[model samples]
Target: MEFPDGLVADTFARTWEMLLPSGTPGTAGLPARKLALAGPGLPDPGPAADIVLVPTHPQTGKAWQPPSGTAAVVPLSAEVWLHLAFPRDRLLVPATGGLPDGVLRDDPPPLHPAAPFRPDARIFFGTLARLPAVREPWLRTLHDHARHRFPHSFR
Candidate 1:
């Protein structure tokens, strides 16, 4: 998971911060003020994440996998990745869709986590850098996506 050079890594980090939906995706029950990214400025990028999300080959037609278990980060990452890979430009759902099936308890085990939080993505990106094949491209794509997600940070 080798990453692009330092420049690209920096770009990706900055973009991720910007583009990611502010606060936890579905943590609505909690107070809005408690959301990490709800403040005027970016929340302290949270703590260094240590979760390990397994990986799976993208389905032939689908780019993402279904959710698994009570917790899986892969599904969440896939949704965000699809948005980054295929943005609609307008305030609409991105052209790229997400995994069709959800991770089933009775079905075969998922290759990765179902839906990870932000810190998970950060750690995942760091690990992704170690792999040589998709390292730089992943970084570049993720960076672009991040920029699209958060233009304010780049400014």
Candidate 2:
């Protein structure tokens, strides 16, 4: 298991970050995000179309654990992922690194470990794209960040 060994171009990432709002369809600001670990003073990013940037690779089957350095963006909705993870489908939630102010959220709890978090935009992002409530352009920002800012390479 290898992580993103390449460094994403800072300038290019900054460019996309700035242009994120425009690329997104509705909102003008970044979406609410939280850490992926349960710690004192860590706040949930709310039940909206929140995001959790997590370890592209996880350390356990639980929902929240510390990251292994590299990040895989998980556009999670607390209300939805919780409902799904609470009962069945451990694969529903990705393992995250930590909470905001650095890495990412502590949602779904670490009770039910999962199959290591991997970046599956087609599965995760595609789910968000189909939702009407998550129409804020900020979602698009995340999408652009994944596609443009952090590409496999410059080519």
Candidate 3:
């Protein structure tokens, strides 16, 4: 079944809320432009960039690390790492210093016989492979939804 954009965003937001710490602060809004890969070996979306949201810790006011293997191993700040994950509803500040739930998982049999990656990431990469032009529209929809849902965060 084809999932509507609203349903997909809502599902993602709900999943993010469940994974975030109880009092974690929301992100500092979506990035101004698409995110650039911070490392050399990561898959490059080129012009079809993805929206990345930078989340901050509520208490310490620090940024959380990106879950390992979710994306490329970048040397950017922790906030940048958080942004790449795109937990739009709230900051996915890990409660136990481990990977957040439902973010990354074992690769499906089609992609890799034995490996791990985020399913969403795989879909994203797959789309980029098939139609490079699809990236902007996909990210635009997400950014628009986020701007509508959380107007305060954008400013």
Q: Top model by lDDT, which number?
A: 2
lDDT of 2 by residue, 13-117 (tens): 334334454543234566433223221133442332123432222334334432342333353344334433333444434556324475444465545336433
TM-score of each: 0.19, 0.27, 0.20
Query: Candidate 1: what lDDT?
Result: 0.35
lDDT of each: 0.35, 0.40, 0.38
lDDT of 3 by residue, 101-144 (tens): 67773543222125322235344334445754435654344434
- Pitting candidate 1 against candidate 3, the one with the higher lDDT is 3
Q: In candidate 3, which residue ranges exceed 4 Å CA deviation?
A: 1-135
| Residue-level lDDT for 41 in candidate 2 | 30
Q: Model 3 clash pairs?
A: 53-83
Model 1: runs farther than 4 Å from truth?
A: 1-116, 119-121, 135-139, 147-155
* Candidate 2 to truth, TM: 0.27
Model 3 error, position 15 (Å): 6.4
